[model samples]
Target: ATSVRRGLRSTLRLGNRLAEEWWRQGIAWRAMRRGEVVVFDRHFFADYHAYDIAGTDLPLSRRLHGFLLAHAYPKPDLVIYLDAPPEVLLARKGEGTIEALARRRQDYLSLAAVTTSFEVVDATRTLDEVTSEVIALIRAFEQRHGAMATTS
Candidate 1:
């Protein structure tokens, strides 16, 4: 509850800052076009934003429509979906309660629909396997896309 509220507040509040928004989008797009193998820590908006309390329903199509109208369709080039059991996720819980963690996990699954470039990875694997798989996929993407450059 607290996390959801805070995340909403930050997003809505940040939305008011056009400069930040533009800067972020600019950097992200730049990196993308440069062919940099960038990994977004949390590209989970529909997860947090497109939801109602008590975990009822989300009008995801509405958001997709908005993105399309904004010419934001055909979204990211690739998205990696990391899926692990709740127990596995909970094993690494930092501070949030089980309930919050569950909410976040479900949110990711829900948002998975809006993305086309999604790769689902079973979190049941060992850390080494996960890293290796991610690296291989990213390398493949880079190979096909011709390496990415970073300005920073």
Candidate 2:
């Protein structure tokens, strides 16, 4: 238990350091500043709680680290979570077990539940269908917020 706690703390500290550096780079922020749609392949939220470190009492340090990392960069205006079944993910990736995939799916669902600006899309559908859904969502967002300026 002690070792698991230490490992979690170490991982979080490293993640926090890397996120701070990325925030300083301003790559995402610059694009958003110019009204460009920033598509993040994998955001901090996914990675922050990727591991399930077993412990009855989560340390305050861990919570603080998560809070700081989350606040390191401005939250995205919209987060589109593409979700697929565990079996589908396993068939495609040929890596993680169904249990692991299911756990991740639950984590993502829980995160989406708490987040104010988030949408979940079924990725088990055809690629074209998924793309169309995402495009439709983006269009709706644009209609609501007005079109973003194309040029910086």
Candidate 3:
């Protein structure tokens, strides 16, 4: 019965994630179809890998579901990971511990390494510097795709 309960929980979670992904993707698709550039604050797979589903403490069911959902989701054209030292992240967030933040940062780096279009911008820099770097990346992507800037 415990295994059955785990299965049910996993199934429900998978369904919910898929539904959310479908809705979010619809928004992105519509925007892109209108020749607009869409930037997502955080991709679902990256968040899952860092926070919820990557740890060994999680059940096998959840890990499996996460794997499925990750594969099902479409890969982004560009993934900009704003990276900073763990101490800086902890100070800024006032939430997670330094060690935990460090681990999560490493996870993000690993994810970036695997992705085709990934950039790690130094978030420890000034806001203008970071913004400029991100803008440059987007502009490069737009140029490569022959896309004219429709909106800022």
lDDT of each residue in 91-139, candidate 2, tens digit only: 9999989999999788777666545567889999999999999988888
Candidate 2 off by > 4 Å:
1-16, 19-21, 49-61, 70-72, 147-152
Task: Please give the CA lDDT of all the candidate structures.
Answer: 0.58, 0.69, 0.78
Clash pairs detected, candidate 1:
35-148, 36-148, 79-117, 81-119
Question: Would you list the clashing residue pairs of candidate 3?
Answer: none
* Ranking of candidates on TM-score, top first: 3, 2, 1
lDDT of 3 by residue, 1-152 (tens): 99898788888877787788778878888788798888989877677765444556666656765665556666677789999998998788799898988887889898875577888899999999999999999999888867733322
The predictions' CA RMSDs to the true structure, in order, are 7.1, 5.1, 3.8
TM-score of each: 0.60, 0.73, 0.82
Candidate 3 to truth, TM: 0.82
Pitting candidate 2 against candidate 3, the one with the higher TM-score is 3
Give the least accurate 10-residue stretch of model 3, judged by summed lDDT: 143-152
- Model 1 regions more than 4 Å off: 1-19, 44-49, 52-74, 140-152
Model 3 regions more than 4 Å off:
1-3, 50-60, 148-152
> Cα deviation in Å at residue 54, candidate 3?
7.3
Which is the leading candidate under lDDT? Answer: 3
